[model samples]
Target: MPAPNAWVLTEGHAGMESQAVGLAEALGLTPEPRRLRARLPWDWLPGRLWPVPLMGVTTEQGPLAPPWPGVAISCGNVSAPVCAALRRRGVKAVHVQHPKMDPAAFDAVVAAVHDGITGPNVIVTRNALHRATPERLAAARAEWMPRFAHLPRPLVAVLVGGTNGRFRLDGEVGADVAERLAGMMERDKVGLYVTPSRRTGEDAKRALADRLVPLGAEIWDMQGENPYFGLLACADAIVVTCDSVSMMSEAVASSVPVFILDLPGKSRRIGEFIDMLVRDGRVRRFDGRLETWPVTPLDDTPAAAAEVKRRLGL
Candidate 1:
């Protein structure tokens, strides 16, 4: 018998693509491996108004067939309509994150706890799903270890995220966080592996680099030579800014004690998630010092995949 064919739709964004790919891997499904193009005429519009295509568009040209997949999963706001369209055609659709419309429309909605959504079909998780396979981690360790071998032990991984919603991660904040991190590094005599996301502004990146350069720390931008998973796998401890849910989720998933850099006037969603982690003793807030805490690795992807399989009777 042939392996089950899954038509995975990864419109344009990297985060969406990652989630789709991760879900496909977890479900043991082989994706068609063809990119799907989505046309957004109103993407340039300001004030949060977006117009997206409802049907799946071929990466090259033309529209895809209705009921294109045994199952369809979407991660971002833009792909929700497409998934809904697939659901209308009897395709099993699972929506991840907060879709623009009513989530009840989807066959299954895997929402984070911070989204404040609860329902029978909705599986509320504390963090977004991520899969760090052993092969992937091994590759990261092999590739990144030798390059930084001469550096100090107990390396600190600083994962910087850009501004979103009410949380603004500006240059000033990066500078302040970097100052505190540098102090910790000085006391511990450990090297720093700094990685910045696309949302991280050029000014913030410059500020972090400026402060850490004088301290003899290594900095890696998203456009830099190293892949991000390598930094995450090889780091001793991770310090993540409170701006990104996905980043924090991946860090905690690594089974490392994650330290969150507190942001001023953070959004309630961010605050709620952080509070849950603290209450569970999964993470701690960095207060200008190196503190130790115990953490348990969370593997939500496997449970989510199993649930999806059971729902679809796969």
Candidate 2:
């Protein structure tokens, strides 16, 4: 169970919510998740637009007035004002990611190195926080191991992400990715287990599937239960897209060898992060060659959580 006086707040964004929850669990807290929704035009404003409660949340879920909490973990720009408000009331507020507001507003801010945010209360990490602990992965492996038993040995997991502000997955890049995977299947004699994210459009998924399925690859089309964590658990190796730093981070954190596929983009942050990983031998770039090597799983979630706990004197 979580600490009675600790709460995790987010705008319900999946990535940010995961970070908050990961931190909460790291601190030995289960956390009561609080979702904040902005009221109309106020949602259009930036996180640092104004230093007030520009949004509103439903009161029907629980009593609006608070007895207040001793600790609050926040993520995303949408919850920046909430963290500020909590801090003003003497709550030990911990924020994840780069909030648009000043870092001084919170007791501690956990951000990624590529975000390039700096402040007295800031702690930087190489990867995003996630829920992919060894225990969870083991459970997922137990459940999914039988399901994938028919596939060949040396199963390669493909984690696909899609278009973002800085990158695209439409035409040339998609074709190139499919070709590379196909080449690997032909040469390496390994099986493939592919999963595409929500950001990955249907057309792009079909293109990749069309190329790989004939070669004995399986693609989870988001129909029933997701095999995401299961793939992370049982994969002999991982190939992930570069568009999502969060996804890449989670994959690299696992014991399996990780291969990052480059996309067409100008994201200096992602580039810098990948370079660091390559230098540290934590991961490799996919160049139509699939090689396996052992590496001390690259993870920073626990480190960030430890810092947050220290700051709060926990």
Candidate 3:
């Protein structure tokens, strides 16, 4: 018999994987996470070009084998073919992001509006899918409130991301972010809970810590347990670096006010995404100040999940 839960696959990229996992959770399905490791020539070719994609598939968790899942959700390009291979065997395939193939080939495609893909089966969203729903936030707040009691009131959550190939978020850039954040502390009397991603290099972390730490900001080294969920739930306001669309999306989903810290990047898609969110009054650009407004928590993940359930008849 097929499994009772959904199979969520990714290339182990945290941002991509989170989108798939969030959609599965929205659908009330337990997510079985799978990390794809494509071997040899298969890894070179695009997912659409693979003749027998399953032959190229292997996983660190285990080998891809029989007793297929009833549904599979994939996010990254490399993981799309695995979902497609499973789809041929009666699995309902749902891909997040542009599949780079015919949208009709999959049961459903959850694409970002910036991708510019539209089809009957495609569910386009203004914001990226994330797991910061009200239920999860409530649970997180209950679990994390006591842990964060030491931090001062009017807590500000800073979701820090670092340099990618396209963005220059180095030590100098990090220090610049710190200076902007320091303005908030000085002006609003706020306490900051900053969480840096692995992409934040040691030099960048040092630069950020040198300034932010002395200003009474507690930066998470990303060493022990992650306080991401807690910070999202408990913070009065949120500021995220522009390098990560995922961070921006998740931060906006919370009830708190969200601000995107501009970085030196030429990512057109990210720029478009930010523009749409700003136009919709969901977010604002950070300019050395903390501002609050009426917040309408984003419901894009549940919306995508509803489309998946409707079209797939699950």
Candidate 4:
């Protein structure tokens, strides 16, 4: 028999939702994405009130609880209170990524080793888990290959991300990176598949299009229909900015070698994580070389799922 329904919650963020979906797939569980509602009066206090809307608004009718699933898996800070509510009703709660609060609140916490969170209930991984199955990769290749069929022989994938309050992804930086990549493309007659994240700045997107798109590259803004996975699957090599660990993790999951763009003043956690990966020979920094190295895949989703199942005896 199939596993019981799992409720997955995200605050409308693609990355968090993607991770929840990936974990559900890895665990062979059916996940139903549910919108969460806030239950606290403090949730409506001014600028702090963002969570009220992000987590659906509470009503005079009652506490708007969605259908209770056998399990609840959540990502990001917004899901904490919602997960707690589910737990109160004896629902199993599994949280992916550091809770940004206490780990003890969740039944199991799946965190990145670089997150510096260690606990009995915590499962640390080198990178975030993703669902990059061979079937998905094959499908992506089939869909994207024809678009770049006439561009060039070798293709380079540039995955762009924007600032996350702690960092800045400026147009000048994108131009600089694009220039360096364009130089490499010129020498190798390379094709380019560039995709920007939702956080990616408008100026950066424009800069990339103005500087790199005309050089036989296909640029995908948020409006573009192509899936980012297709770019990762079809590229000879990937160039990712140092802002997103999830993006880096997905790139490493691909068979191709990944090169991270330089971010001088980014978080120390990112630096430490990159250092560990480099020392372990999993990924390389962008230094004008396309080389492949064997990577020890550290997929935590299955392990986490197994542990959860074992705990629940399901």
Best-matching candidate per lDDT: 3
Name the TM-score of candidate 1.
Answer: 0.85
Which candidate, 2 or 4, would have the higher lDDT against the true structure? 2
In model 3, state the lDDT of residue 239: 91
Model 3 TM-score, 2 decimals:
0.95
Model 2 residue pairs with clashes? 2-30
**Higher-lDDT candidate among 3 and 4?**
3
TM-scores vs. true structure, each candidate: 0.85, 0.91, 0.95, 0.86
Candidate 4 lDDT tens digits, 52-80:
33344443434446566778888877676
Better of 2 and 4 by TM-score: 2
Off by over 4 Å in 4: 1-3, 35-41, 44-63, 292-298
Candidate 3 structure quality by residue, lDDT tens digits, 1-314: 53369999998888998999999888878899989898887889887788988888789877788778888999888888778888989999999999988888789999999988999889999888988899889999999989889888788999988889778888788878888888889898898988988788888788889988898989897788899999999998999988888889899889888998898978888889989889989899999888889998876888788878888887
Could you give candidate 2's per-residue lDDT for residues 1-314 as a string of tens digits?
63655777887766677788888888877677787777666667775674466234332245224776778888877777777777888788998888878898898999998888989899999888888887888899999999989999899999999988998898567778999999999999999999998889877888898888999999998999999999998989999999887888889878999999988886888888888889989999998778977788878988888998898888
lDDT of 2: 0.84
Instruction: Please provide the root mean square deviation of candidate 3 (C-alpha atoms, Å).
Output: 1.8
Q: Lowest summed-lDDT stretch of 10 residues in model 2?
A: 54-63
